[model samples]
Target: MKLETTHASADVASEVVFEAKGLKKEYDDGRVHALRGVNFRITQGEFVVILGPSGCGKTTLLQMLGALAEPSAGILHYRGKSLADLADPASYRAREIGIIFQAFHLLPTFTAVENVQMPMFETDRPAAERTERAVELLKLVALGHRLDHFPSKLSGGEKQRVAIARSLANGPTVLLADEPTGNLDSENSKKILELIIRLRREQNMTLVLVTHDLNIARMATRTIEMKDGLIVADQQVPQTAA
Candidate 1:
């Protein structure tokens, strides 16, 4: 079957980086349904927010979209291709998706640059090139000077920055962040939010963020609310001109 291609004007970004159809999840023999036929699409370079109360399946949906978890029943298309076609999803995750969690998840013993380079260590890139790329990513996150600092020496926000740099190391197409600001104070949360927005704008990355904060939801170009394992509301909000 031939796939349809709608010609988008140069001004318009790609239609969607990800598409989910009839997504459903069940655990404990139908006792718990985490997601009930959830459906959504994330456009290229768009900042999207998944907002809901606790146990609303927001994070579950995000994980499915990131390829970190599989949906019991659903169709997921990444960049218009079925995710199931990927020969090795671990490689796909490393190459296509960057994930950030509430926990910084940085290596305790490694310095910031070393943590950033960890993702690419298996690649054949020369050590010098890997170091240079790590430096560049650190600079992108405004952490070039902290290259030698371990997570123990960094504050909450700085550690998050290192995580962000590590995520960008492979230049992923989609960035999935789950409650990225949940662990930070108001000031640090704002800083992390700003950094996320900046990455979306400057890097043209597709962003899918899950959060319980309405203020954080309002910052995205699109806001989607979930409840009872289903999407309750989906809307595209106005964003500043790029």
Candidate 2:
């Protein structure tokens, strides 16, 4: 699909934040195909919900977008640059992409502040700067009071809040979330979704969220539905959907 996009940045000068051409991922010696050559383009400033049932390859697609895994076939691009060509994929991830996993992947031994500071270490900022940024981000996520608390000491909602703070540690432009509210109760899920929407607008970040919940998908400006590893639907959401 050719999604014509107007350039959005003065640096990369591209509106297309991500483009997947014939993207594929296979496992178990090609016996299982997680993704079957799906293609799509995400533009800047878009709130995109990737909706599908479990095992529909939504998470696999998100992983490729985050550079957390490689595609078994085809290519993925960020701002028109191939992900495979990145000199340091870790550096790219830390600087350009923010990721929220389904599991709140917080370090049990590290405090919330310390966990938030982990991504900034990839940057050249001084310790004091990293500390300041972490504090700022935690406060942004309403977790400032829990800065000194470890993952084991926090509630599920609190821990996920810490994870959200950690994801924004390095100020990435692209935010890839894989079912962030899956572990939370209804109230917490609402809170988390509100926080995420507010953050995306405040930061003007490109958000590609993966979820099966139609309630969540309704709030998005766009939704891409996947089935058995192929994109079945991609459409602009109606104003009333939100």
Estimated TM-score for each candidate = 0.91, 0.93
Q: Give the runs in model 2 whose Cα sits over 4 Å from its true position.
A: 1-14, 239-242
- Cα deviation at 19, candidate 1, in Å, is 0.8
Model 2 lDDT on a 0 to 1 scale: 0.86
lDDT of model 1 at residue 117? 93
Error of 1 at 212 (Å): 0.6
Instruction: Judging by lDDT against the true structure, name the best candidate.
Output: 2
Count of steric clashes across candidates, in order:
0, 0
Tens digit of per-residue lDDT, candidate 1, span 1-242: 11111222233377677888999988888899999998888877888999999999998898788777788898989878877566788877777778898899999999999999987775677999999888888888889899999999999999999998888777776789999999999999999889988886766777889999988877888999999899999998777622
Which candidate number maximizes TM-score?
A: 2
